[model samples]
Target: MRLEEIVIDNLRKLRRLISVRRMDDAEEAACKIVKYIFEDAPVLGLDLDGTIDEAPEFFRLLSRIWPGRVVIITCRLDEDKARADADKFGVFYDELVTVRKLEDKAEAIEQTGVTVYVDDQDECLMDIPMDVTVLKIRNEGNFTDGKWLYSGRTGKQIC
Candidate 1:
């Protein structure tokens, strides 16, 4: 189902802890997320984790599909960076929010009326409310065409 809004919880996505690849690829891959929330009037909230690649091409893709409409939630409680990043992403938040803990993700998302949230960490995902769409990130191996890896409770995907 197409979510009313898309929420990205991490800037690195998964490349930060998982397999070491070029930063550009991960950023571009993140860009694809914009397609899910294309155009209309719905909003997009990307939870910036204070990473350099917070705004990527995937965001631009969303903007192209949907003009001037997006929201951003920052975990660091850093308003300045969030605003600047919002400008960089081209998907400006109708309003910017900041919090001290990741656990606040669900509460924060709920307040904004978000339906889908994309996050790399399972912990952060758990923190959010269940009503929202939780698009948790998986390692590249999980997305492999042939052999798929199931990341059990330990966060280690067994091939």
Candidate 2:
């Protein structure tokens, strides 16, 4: 089976398990999904300003855990400052791309072949193609209303 198929199947199983109140089975299924994704080594694209700066520690931990290459895509003009922030926060990333415009992020993602991307800005999220899975980081500033894959006040993953 393809990677997407396996992920979808596991997600369905997880949903069913959760609905049936089978907590243990649901947890196991969730673990399997995460393992499969990491094993596949999907290139993870992350935003710098709102997403990473909001919770640097979480991103740092995720970089350590994720086996794939992590790319930081930002519209920030100052590459030096962005690099400094990454260094200060100890966030591991394979590349740092500074786009000329926020709308150019979609092109950057395409160029880098990012399979999964996370950002807090709705504008950036809107232009990304359907092929790439986009996760909107919920914050007071943006994504206040919409059917996002996940929602949380803080940058940390809520589950």
- Number of the top-ranking candidate, with TM-score as the measure: 2
TM-score of 2: 0.65
C-alpha lDDT of candidate 2 relative to the true structure: 0.82
- Tell me the lDDT of candidate 1: 0.55
Models 1 onward score TM values of 0.53, 0.65
CA-only RMSD, every prediction: 13.5, 12.3
Q: Runs in model 1 with CA error above 4 Å? A: 1-43, 50-55, 67-69, 137-159
Tell me how far candidate 1 lies from the true structure as C-alpha RMSD in angstroms.
Answer: 13.5
lDDT of 1 by residue, 66-156 (tens): 4334556667666887678767766534667787776787777789876656554454556566566665444452446764344464266
For residue 17, what is the lDDT in candidate 2? Answer: 100
Question: Candidate 2, after superposition: displacement of residue 81 in Å?
Answer: 1.0
Query: For model 1, how many clashes?
Result: 1
Model 2 lDDT, residue 94, Cα: 86
